[model samples]
Target: MSASHVVYVLSCADDSLYTGYTTDLERRVAEHNAGEGAKYTRGRTPVAVVHSESHESRSAALSREYEIKQLSRARKLELVGGE
Candidate 1:
């Protein structure tokens, strides 16, 4: 059995969007809220998991993360239902 790999988008406290890969979505979101996640998200705490996609492997998740990161802010928001 293997853990799930996830590509996720977060809506930050400052209304910024962040994209990242994680195996544990819930825990990662908690870490972001605690100001212990990615450096970019540290100052933008209280992040919410606005979007997420599960992949079979870490590589797939990471690749998707990269792809999402390349999207413009408007596009990213579209992925999260324009929230």
Candidate 2:
């Protein structure tokens, strides 16, 4: 079976950004929306997956997540089309 891997960015209710890696992007996003995801998102609630990249492996997706997280807010804003 193919391994599921993803790097995703969520726009929280407060308009903050959250970055993470997941094996199941849909389920992870649903969890975040349900307020059962990360602690940072718990208080924010109503998170949405604004961006996602699939990778061949978990390690690769995690590496991408780190890279995305390290980007400045301006760079990230550019990535998300400044929405």
Candidate 3:
């Protein structure tokens, strides 16, 4: 098993962005799609996995998540192909 935390980007139903971290990426994605994920995603179902990266530690994943959150929408779009 991968001893890493996964940072994921979700494209929401409203065409918004959501970033988070999890050890089980597939399960997390499923939760989000089912509207049982993050509070922000509860109302806006995740449409797709826009981006995903793994880190050696949860701290690293969190740091990366913060950085990605700070990025402009345009740059984030560049990071993950825009729809």
Candidate 2 least-lDDT 10 residues: 74-83
Per-candidate clashes come to 0, 0, 0
Model 1 scores a TM of: 0.92
lDDT of 3 by residue, 1-25 (tens): 5667999999999999888899999
Superposition-based RMSD of candidate 2 using all C-alpha atoms, in angstroms: 1.4
Clash pairs for candidate 3: none
lDDT of each: 0.89, 0.87, 0.89
lDDT of 2: 0.87
When 1 and 2 are scored with TM-score, the better candidate is 1
Q: Which candidate is the best by TM-score?
A: 1
lDDT for model 3: 0.89
List the lowest-lDDT window of 10 residues for candidate 1: 1-10
TM-score of each: 0.92, 0.91, 0.89
Candidate ordering by TM-score (highest first):
1, 2, 3
